[model samples]
Target: MSYTDDERIRAKRRALYILAQRDHSKKELYDKLIKNYPPDLCEMVVGLMCEHDLINEEKYTEKLYRAYINKGWGKSKIRFELRRKGLPDSLISQQEEEYDTEDFIDEIMHLVDKKYASKLDFSDYKSVQRVTAALARRGFAYDDIKLALSRIKDGDYDEYDE
Candidate 1:
């Protein structure tokens, strides 16, 4: 089967509509269009979109970073998501510098604090280990997790001694 001129136009328009809903990397847009159109035609459409400023890798990368940050994801998780989306490593590296490590750590700390607030009794080693694992899963490094855990443990100990 072959797409007519009208069908090709409609497919391109539909691809753009899908992209309009959210920022997509160029490879992603190309892959989506290729599902319905020929590879060459999809490449042309992607090129046209780029020329028209409809799809920009840099802008998409920045938007992705901010979106993940807003969702409280750490740099490591954000980097991985961006990579999975087919974003270039250089682009991700450039955008990574825009995020401060301390800020990411603070976000992790806030999440941990809120989650463990009620279960602060620290009844056993398992509790601390569980909380540490939770923070690690959030993309925090071991040192940061240990520091946050230490603070929580110290706070609990003081409360119990009194």
Candidate 2:
């Protein structure tokens, strides 16, 4: 079905409005516009948005990667969320490579110190298990969580440097 020029304008305006609030993946923009407009129109608008640099998967991926990392999220969970947001595997992989390996470990340790440092007791099996499960739910691996716990137990992690 052919869309009128006015409808086309409305679709474009709505797309811009959504984008202005925050950056969205190309697929995200398409999904939102497709709800109110025809598939073809939404496709056209999404295509134009891509062509004009209005929505960039790489940029969005990097932004999200940095944000989640700063928030002390693990790589596995970050990758899952990026994929859910419609980011390509290549971009997500590239973003992961762009950061140093130490950064990931540091982030994990930082999370432990900030959130679970006090209640985590290696002597208490239940306490240790609870902290491990919590970190796993946050996308941290078992080995990494164990390492962080050991570091904290050994008094190697300094939580009061702030």
Candidate 3:
């Protein structure tokens, strides 16, 4: 059966509403729309939105990258999230360069210090292993983790345990 013009307009309006909720990659928005509308109609609506500058994959990718970085996610996790959202590899690469590596290292260190402060014991191998594993899971490299751990003062650990 064919859809009426009013129905097509309604579908396009709904698609725009969804886009307004957040930035969406072209493929992601299209997939969402196709679930409720005809594939061809979804494509048409997407094209119109692009023409109006309402749907932009580059802008969407950049926003997603910024949001993820602000949440203190590392490059690997950020890349994975962007890929899952259908962002191009080149765009992801370009956006990743905008993240400050020093800031990321500081954030990782802050998180590690908070979580392992009370558990630290310089003489205990198991404690060091646990702290290192925690930092690694937070997306920090081994060397960075080691360096941060080295900077944790004995007094800080003692105070935390108290």
Most accurate candidate by lDDT: 2
Which pairs in model 2 have colliding backbones?
A: none
Worst 10 residues of 2 by lDDT: 153-162
After superposing candidate 3 on the true structure, give the runs of residues whose Cα lies further than 4 Å from its correct spot: 1-4, 151-162
Residue 110 of model 3 has an lDDT of 68
Root mean square deviation (Cα) for candidate 1 = 4.5
Residue 8 Cα positional deviation in candidate 1, in Å, after optimal superposition: 4.0
RMSD after CA superposition, every candidate: 4.5, 1.7, 4.2
Task: Give a tens-digit lDDT track for model 3, residues 1-162.
Answer: 578999789988887898889878778888899888888888888888888888788888888887876676667778888898888899998886876665666666566566666787878999889877876665667776676567564333333333
Q: What ordering of candidates by lDDT runs from best to worst?
A: 2, 1, 3
Q: What TM-score does candidate 3 reach?
A: 0.77
User: Per-residue lDDT tens digits of candidate 2, residues 1-162?
Assistant: 898999999999999999999999988999999899989999999999899999988889999999998877888899999999999999999998987656665677787778887877788999988888888888776777777777777777665346
Error (Å) of candidate 2 at residue 127 is 0.9
lDDT of 2 at 43: 90
List candidate 2 segments past 4 Å from native: 158-162
